[model samples]
Target: MFLSTFFVVFLLGVGQAQPEDRSKGLPTSFPVPHTDDMLFYLQRSRNENTVIYDLNRKADGTVDAGNPINVYYIRFARDGKPWPLKWIERKFAYGYSHKKLKNQSGFQIELVAYDERKIELIPS
Candidate 1:
């Protein structure tokens, strides 16, 4: 019984000793962007710049039927301001296309670069 307990404790200790994966090695000092309509953001180890995804809303505060999400970049490495992606970046990197569901439930989003994984956005 004591041997088994010791082995279990050792395993737990080893697990705790492992370093945590910190946002794919993003710098901890980088400031996280925030906005009222922001849904989420993606960061990369390549640079401090961040990609922001925000809900596109109408004047009445409802989700836009045609364009439901706005994707842009927060250029932290530059002046820390939001900027539209260039044509090349939009075509090859972070651009995405979304389609409203036929069932009127939500929008189906597919990344231009990585289309194998689909993201569904449902408004509350």
Candidate 2:
């Protein structure tokens, strides 16, 4: 009788020690247009100037299946015009979704210089 009781107590203790589900408290929806902001970590390669990272939702702020669309970052020059390049040579920033304009699915991000910012992207 003592052995059986101890075994049951041990099992209960083990169960309690296990970690809780990490996604239980996460948000289900992405940032909304003109009403929300989502930060992202940006990186660049030799061929591409910008790549999106640490985003949980799709560009349209909808649940993504597996493959999400890639949106490149654009920088405007001092002449009040966008840079003309086939691909950005080198660029990196930490930006957040600022607004969702007409015809845009995801929020348009406003990027600044890189920093040690950490963003937790919800997993699909």
Candidate 3:
């Protein structure tokens, strides 16, 4: 009876040890060639930069899926103009169907860059 109870407890402990997330292979977004921002995105949700990383069993625990997208590296063309949020939208078709876009682009992404952490998309 004692051994059976111990085995059950051990199994439960193993399952509980599992983390809530797994890391995906998506690379962190790099700058657009001029700026210093970092970016990473989810291909499944082309327009959405809220890339989620699922729990992945990697050799090192440092890397994982679903890291937040960084947008410091890319630069705007005009001096004052910024990389439009629409750029990510149109690039990934944020509002449009992803399946259609995927067929053409095969899940590529355009990284965005900004100094402030807040996404410019939301209206002030």
Per-prediction TM-score to the true structure, in the order listed: 0.71, 0.22, 0.18
- Model 1 bad stretches (over 4 Å): 1-28
Per residue, candidate 2 scores C-alpha lDDT tens digits across 50-93 of 33333445767773434222333433112222233333322333
lDDT (Cα, 0-100) at 84 in candidate 2: 31
Residues 23-99, model 3: lDDT tens digits: 45433452223233222333331221233212222456432223223322112223433343445653443321111
Cα lDDT of model 1 by residue, 1-124, tens digit? 9999999999999988968776785666767898999988888877889999899899998988788888899999889999998898878888889888788689999989899999989867
Candidate models: Cα lDDT each: 0.87, 0.40, 0.34
Residue 98's lDDT within candidate 3 is 14
Clashes of each: 0, 1, 26
User: What order do candidates take by TM-score, descending?
Assistant: 1, 2, 3
- Residue 80, model 1: Cα distance from true site in angstroms: 1.5
Runs in model 3 lying further than 4 Å from the true structure = 1-32, 37-67, 71-76, 87-124
Candidate 2: deviation at residue 16, Å?
Answer: 67
Considering lDDT, which of the candidate structures 2 and 3 is the better prediction for this target?
2
TM-score of 2: 0.22
RMSD of 1: 9.5
Taking every candidate in turn, the Cα RMSD to the unseen true structure, in Å, is: 9.5, 17.7, 18.4
